[model samples]
Target: MSAGPEIRTIFWDVGGVLLTNGWDIDQRGRVLTALGVDLAAYEAVHDEVNFFWERGLISARDFFERTVLETNPQLALTFEQLWKLVCDESKMLHPECFEMIAHLRRAGSYRLATLNNESKELNRHRIDSFHLRRFFDYFICSGYIHEMKPLPEIYRAAIDISGFAAETAIFIDDKAENCDAARSFGMIPIHFQSPAQLRVSLAQLGIAI
Candidate 1:
């Protein structure tokens, strides 16, 4: 049989692309301060908890409970409170980035989808609040998939659902490791820094801005 047809899909990572400046460094600092935890200590806790969460080894609630127990026992906070704190600290979507996605969607040249490492509740808010669901052909949330970025299974799932071949797909993400992971799967991975840079890079790839 002939080889599979070329992929013509674009998979975007939501946090850095659509939700610009959302996960700001200062916001993390603020979260730590509000929790009465040291920055280094909080980071260590976050790393550990996030590792388990990303690997699908634990539920978000469990991760939060364990994180608080190990990192900030002095605070005496519940999982719900911690969840609210983290959610509240994140910024909203940037208008320009939303416009960019709109442009890509309306251009009708590529199949667009979003793969985000976000909780189901938060993603629901994002989708509804921003009316983002209307723009993409598919939206995959890690919480629903129980798999997160840098994981081949999650990427494969997105590809399978989109019915797109690996080579024809272009994946955009802010993290180098995530981009590298997509490249390993034979996708054209674009490291996203800014909208202007993305325009230039996509133009180089013969994708209209």
Candidate 2:
């Protein structure tokens, strides 16, 4: 069997793939535990407000006010405090993955871009704080586009924006569903497990980093 065409563009997912999941269950648990907040009460409405929150429809203050503070008024934590905790935890990025990106850029073999799901504030903070702009040609953020992953339109939008044919590009994400969506759009998909695993996968596609 022969390998596929040379991958011209590389699409990466931020959360879980490049960085830790923003405001995910583990981070939420740690933050809430430190704040002495009730996990059950917060989770009861997290699913309802999280989508809107991630889409930039609501501010961090508003999200916490409606979901956590309003539901559990006995909690003494303020919005700023809660926001700080979440932001701090969400900004953790894998250094090896970044090194890999830098190596890919040095090789000049592929155009790198990010297809990530994040809120406006969180996204802005993360990119700026991490200096992630140096690593990618473009960023396809769900908050900016009002679209999330595992959806077809976002993948289509990425392909259009990147100016690369779907067959000549590869999308790397930690989620199987997101990878499947990329495949459905005719882009190659890589289910990222670790930097080493990703290196092997990319090597198989003639993309060494």
Candidate 3:
């Protein structure tokens, strides 16, 4: 499992790793309550609707409309309002994770890139506000590619752009399934749980912390 010194590319997941995703279940309940929707009533549908959107089976507009109708049937809110709430609640960058990225970039040992399942609006916001675009050699967003991961093509695209062989690339993702996908494609996969865990894993892979 040695990465060896030739490993020159690293791909990162956005949600749950770079950004905070899915509000605390408790906090989500509170928000639903404020919106006059019963937390338990909408929970399952909310989860399913998001899954559909992430899988690219449904458009964002359809997802938003369905969510408003199923979750807050009594409330009168436009699709714009629903979109803003959902995006704002799910999208937040962890400072510690950003600091680690800064550290990696400073080391200049790997070509950094992001492969994320995110909307264009959220991606643009991150690029501008986080200035994350400056740190990466490439940024591949699902919305832009029309291909969300754990798909091989998305990973291949990143690999091709960075000009790194899959065998010599490292991928960091919060989801076990996504990590497994990378591993299946012959890239070294690091299952990231926290900034500390990621640092330890990268160090183990001989990536300077």
Candidate 4:
């Protein structure tokens, strides 16, 4: 068997692979439930302009206005309050993932970055709260890039931003579809399941944690 290209760069997915999905409806529900707002109605509005919000075409305030405030003029919760509740939902799903990333970072063997679909508010909250900057060299998220996962552009952007060839890159995402897209884009892809399985997968790729 032939050896594959060396993995020089790693692109991580933030929401699922490393932390609790910032997109969980429950995250929204927490804030809405507090404000006596309807989750279904708010979610319907979110589904409509989510692309704009994630693509950096709209601000978080705008998203809240369109989704919450506009529909319910009497909404008692302030944007800041609602923001904090959803932000609270963003937690480290696997401490093992953090330890692994830290070890890899110390090894100085791979360039680290994140490729994810998230709005600016959610992305910033996780990055700040989790101190993710300690591991990742940069973040290639949809919030700033105006592109989302499962799209070829965001994957390419990660490679471009990392200044590495796609063949030398690996993308780790919890979504099989996103992993498939990364594979099609000429990068090694790992469909992350859990910390234990992830360790095994990384070992298979010659990356021992």
- lDDT score of residue 142 within candidate 4: 93
> Relative to the true structure, how large is the alpha-carbon lDDT of every model?
0.75, 0.85, 0.74, 0.86
* Best by the TM-score measure: 4
Give the runs in model 1 whose Cα sits over 4 Å from its true position: 1-7, 20-26, 55-57, 69-78
Clashes of 3: 0
lDDT of 1: 0.75
Regions of candidate 3 where Cα sits further than 4 Å from its true position: 1-5, 22-30, 38-52, 55-59, 69-73, 90-93
lDDT of 3 by residue, 1-209 (tens): 35364788888887788776533465456566777876676775777776666545677778767765555667877777865665566555566777878888888877899988865656766677567777787888776776778888877777777786888888998899999998898888999888888888877887756
**How good is model 2 by TM-score?**
0.93
Model 2 lDDT per residue over 1-209, tens place: 12877678999999887778888899899988877778897888898998888877888788889888877677777888778878889654678889889998888878999998888888888888788899988888888778788877788889999887899998999989999999999999999988889989888888766
How far is 8's C-alpha from truth in model 1 (Å)? 2.4
Query: Which regions of candidate 4 deviate over 4 angstroms?
Result: none
Inter-residue clash pairs, candidate 2: none
My TM-score estimates for the predictions, one after another, are 0.80, 0.93, 0.79, 0.95
**Candidate 1, residue 4: CA error in Å?**
14
C-alpha displacement of 39 in model 3, angstroms? 5.1
Give every collision pair in model 3: none
> How many clashes (backbone N, Cα, C below 3 Å) per candidate?
1, 0, 0, 0
Mind giving the per-residue lDDT tens digits that candidate 1 earns over 1-209? Answer: 11434448988888878774323457668876776777776566677676566555677677766656456677878777776776775565556667778888888878888887876666766677667778888887786777888888898888888886788888889999999999999888889988888877777777766
Per-residue C-alpha lDDT of model 4 across residues 91-202, encoded as one tens digit per residue = 7888889999999999999999999999988888888889989899999989888888898888878888888889899889999999999999899998999989988888
After superposition, candidate 2 runs with Cα above 4 Å error: 1-3, 91-93
